[model samples]
Target: MRTAILVDGGFYRRRAQSRLGEKTAEERADELNKYCRRHLYHHGKQVANLYRIFYYDCLPMDKKVYHPLLQRQIDFSQSDLRTWMYAFIEQLKKKRKFAIRLGKLADEQAQFLLREDITRKLCRSALQVTDLKEQDFLLDVSQKGVDMKIGLDIASLAYKQQVDQIVLISGDSDFVPAAKLARREGIDFILDPLYNPIKPDLFEHIDGLRTCDPHFNPNWSEKESTE
Candidate 1:
């Protein structure tokens, strides 16, 4: 049976950092393939056909701003962290089975005003006005259109009959609808929470709740270590 592996890039990175520890771009790129293949065991046999691996992520935020934590002016383009992340993405793109999907990161305050809670606290003297800082007013950057792209790809995979099964590496419940549709289309939907237990409702939509994390289940990994 042909299977496809899909990943939420942000989710994968955060969990991988915690679970697998930090890895260079080359190491991460190699593990990405290994983790995708670990799920092929169905009824005790691996599926030889891996259709492809789809990874969705946003470009690093590029901005010239004052760093609140560092207390200095900084250009995002010149940041070491940003440079490393881009290199990681580039390494991922080099893999033939992997497809990188790009989205955008939006600065919330660019379109929205300061949060009401902060305003209220300051008015009530709960927060000293003198203590107000630029970081306090700065808004968080959020990924935009990543979920929609994932859903669209799920639909395309199902409707086109590109793969009979899909292994998704994500914790977000945003995939519920897409999973339902794929399951209805007779595609086996498997979810890998990467060491985290997903919401109860999420388990109902997927045909399998399997994870490759050795920490989650020691015995399973012990018996099956090659993957």
Candidate 2:
């Protein structure tokens, strides 16, 4: 069977950081490639040949934004995040059978908001306005064209019958319409949420739900230990 792997890059990065620990850009790219390959196997045996791995993400914001807490203009073009993101994308480009689909950040909508914990503390009067720190705020940037690109690709793949199966690594329900279309085209649709809990309604839309993260699957680790 031929298989295409689609990844929600933002979701994957967040999960990987929380579960797999922090790593450099190059190391994270390598880890992502390996993780996608694990889905090509079933019950310890190869079941499909990889068609390609499509990674979807928005390029980091590179515009200057006014910081509310710091009361200064922050130039994201010189930020470490922008540098690391470019390096990560370059590494993915060098990987065989990898395709990168880049979306863009909505520059006008970009702003900093207090973190959830910080917000709660302020509301309860546990913290004063002066207690706010730069680190307590997060940049809230909206992504554009990512979901559209993913949906378009899924429709194209299904219509062309390019692959027998398509595995999507995302937890968002926005792909439900595309998933339904793929199913009608007789393509096996698999979801890998990386152990994130999804709504029950999502179960009916997928042919299978699977995650290849060894860190979450104890059986996989046990088998590896014995091998």
Candidate 3:
């Protein structure tokens, strides 16, 4: 059967970075293709034919960040770390059967709040800091329009009968409506939520559930759920 795979770029990147560690972008590109194809394998037996891979993400914003601890303004977009990301995306573009869809990063500023546990510890005198001269926080960046694009594409493929099955690599519940539409169109819908907990309500909409493997990131916190 012809299968089209769709991946949430942000989700994939965060999971891979946390789990796989730092591999050169060139190396990661190779692994991305391999990782997608592995899903076609069932318990060591490979089945189905690939149609294409759709990767959805927005570019990092060219925005400045306020570092409370450093007490300075930093241009995050120009960081060497961002250059590494740009190089990685370039490598992904060269892969055959891979389509990268770009979205926009929200321009509004976001603030990072300390984790509740950390805040509690500080209140209980269990947490201490050597430096009292500066505040501590981080800037959070978010994406916009990515979900709409994903849903539109899913609808397009199903309505056009481009593939027999659609495999989505996202944990977000926002795709439930799209999944329902695909099923109504007679397309098999599969989901790979990366072993992250998925709500049963969301789980019931898909035809199958699978992942390339478990998350290798050993740093998951206690509050993270498997649902």
Candidate 4:
């Protein structure tokens, strides 16, 4: 049976950046893909077609310290949009014999705008950081819509029986409901967390779960050389 692995981009990036703070985006992506492929094969599942990799995230603002192109990628949230739109269209098709309904603004699109608003508000807050005082308000670089996207994809895949197994690489409890549904539908769901304790809610729904050991893998310092 073929396996389809879904990755939460925001979750992956945060864990990876915390570990490999000095590594370039290219390095991080490469390592992440490598790790994912290795783990998938470890479970004796062949990755047929590498089905839909819906990267759920939002865009970073221009003023943000993060890379601009990377920010653009976040803003575009292309992969997330692709899957979301595809689901919407599929629903429309099933509802009517010849449905041609246009899709509306997505949850991610709204989140992107809201996050930008929050960033501006944080900058204006009176509790500004002094030279000696650390800033209390942390700005979020639009990483919303990920949970929703992940939830939608899991449910859709389970309903359609797209793959024999679904491997999720996220630690968020928000996915518990969708995972539960997948399990009820007899889909094998596996959760792979990035160096975080798996929540009990996840266990209530998924077929199996495991954490990546930073000690064995040493998520950090993959290489001393910089890009």
Candidate 5:
């Protein structure tokens, strides 16, 4: 069997950071490659040949944006996030059988909003508007063409019969239609949410649910330790 692994980059990064802790760009890239390869095997046996790993993400916003809290123009182009993201992408490009698909940030829709916890506090009357600090806000931006590209790739892979199995590393229900299409094409659709809890409705759309997180999979951790 041939398997193609598709990753939602933003989702993966967030989950990885939360579960595995932060790492340098190079380390993160290596971890991502290792995680994806683990899906090629099951129960200590290789079940499928890797076709390619597809990573979809948007470039960080590079334009200057006025910060309402800081009362200054922030140049995102020089931000550490931009630097780290570029390095990460370059590292991924160097990995064998990796395809990087980049979407773009919606510049016009970019704005800052109160963080979730802060918003909740304000709503509950525990915090006042004057209590808001610069760190209490986060920049919100929309990613354009990411979901569309993922859907298109799924369709293309299914139509071309390029792989017998399609493993999506995402928790988003937005791919339900794409998953349904792949299944109709006789492809096994697997979902690896990295141990994240997904909606129960998502289970019916996938052929299998699995994750290769070392923290959760003892077999994986044992294999790694031996290696």
Candidate 6:
């Protein structure tokens, strides 16, 4: 059967870090591709055309941030310069702590302020705050779009019937509707979830589901790194 591999780049990257140890984007893609090929062949479902690997990621302009690492690769610098403005905003959050004086407020308000002080102390001791560079902060802010892009592409590919089977390598529940549609269309939906298992509702929508263990394999590298 013809098979298509639709990748959620951000999802894969984050999950891969936990399973395969920390790795760059290119290394993560290499590991994922290797496992995918071996799994497909093991199931004896190959032998036909393997459709193009569709990677769904937002454009820099759409994200409103130009990641230097990505921009350097494309040789497109000087894009989205205001992305670093997040640093200024973060500083503002740290500096704007409300203060309360016992004599200036009523009894109930003073008690409320005391509780707030305890909570603030707990927060300060528990959570570790750190600054982010322009690229890192932009990635943190623009991560929501990654899931939307993945869901949209899943529905698009199934509606088009570009391939017989779709290998979705994600644990996102957002694709539940698309998975259900693929099932209705008689398309084999194989979910290659990361170490984190897909939710029960999402699995119920798919035809088949699988997971990649910590063990590494070969026979899946189409070219060099796929980033």
Clashing pairs in 2: none
RMSD of each: 5.4, 2.7, 4.8, 10.5, 3.4, 16.5
Single out the weakest 10-residue window by summed lDDT for candidate 3: 130-139
After superposition, candidate 4 runs with Cα above 4 Å error = 43-52, 63-137, 141-144, 212-227
lDDT of 6 at 144: 36
TM-score of each: 0.78, 0.93, 0.86, 0.59, 0.92, 0.55
lDDT per residue for candidate 1 within 1-227, as digits (tens), equals: 89899999889887787766788877987888777877776556875588999999887777765555446655667777687789889999888888999888874332323457777988899988677666566435789999999999999999999999998999899899999999999999989887676677777899998786574442345446775
Expressed as tens digits, the lDDT of each residue in 1-227 for candidate 5 is 99999999999998888777789999999999998999998888998999999999998988998888888988999999999999999999999999999999998888888899998999999999898899998898989999999999999999999999999999788999999999999999999988777899888999999987666432346567787
Superposed by TM-score, candidate 1 places the C-alpha of residue 180 at a distance from the truth, in angstroms, of 0.8
lDDT of 2 by residue, 90-173 (tens): 999999999999998898999999999999999999999998889999999988999999999999999999999999999799
Q: TM-score winner between 1 and 4, please give it.
A: 1
Against the unseen true structure, what C-alpha lDDT does each candidate score? 0.81, 0.93, 0.82, 0.57, 0.92, 0.53
lDDT of 6 by residue, 1-227 (tens): 88777766556655666546765434444565565565456556555456655554332222233344344222113343223222322322233221111111121211111234344655777422233222332223334355656666667777888778887877677778877888787788888776565566665788886665533223334364463
Give the range of the ten consecutive residues with the poorest summed lDDT in model 1. Answer: 107-116
Shift in Å, residue 58, candidate 1:
1.1
Q: 157, model 6: CA deviation in Å? A: 2.5
lDDT of 6: 0.53
Off by over 4 Å in 2: 216-227
Give the lDDT ranking, best first.
Answer: 2, 5, 3, 1, 4, 6
lDDT (10s digit) by residue, model 3, range 1-227: 89999999889877787777778889888878899999788888879889999999877766776666565767867887678779888998999999998888775765455556666777888777543233344346678889999999999999999999999998899999999999999999999877777898776799998877655435454467454
The per-prediction tally of clashing pairs is: 0, 0, 3, 3, 0, 0
List ranges where model 3 is wrong by over 4 Å.
123-125, 128-136, 215-227
**Per-residue error (Å), model 4, residue 199:** 2.3
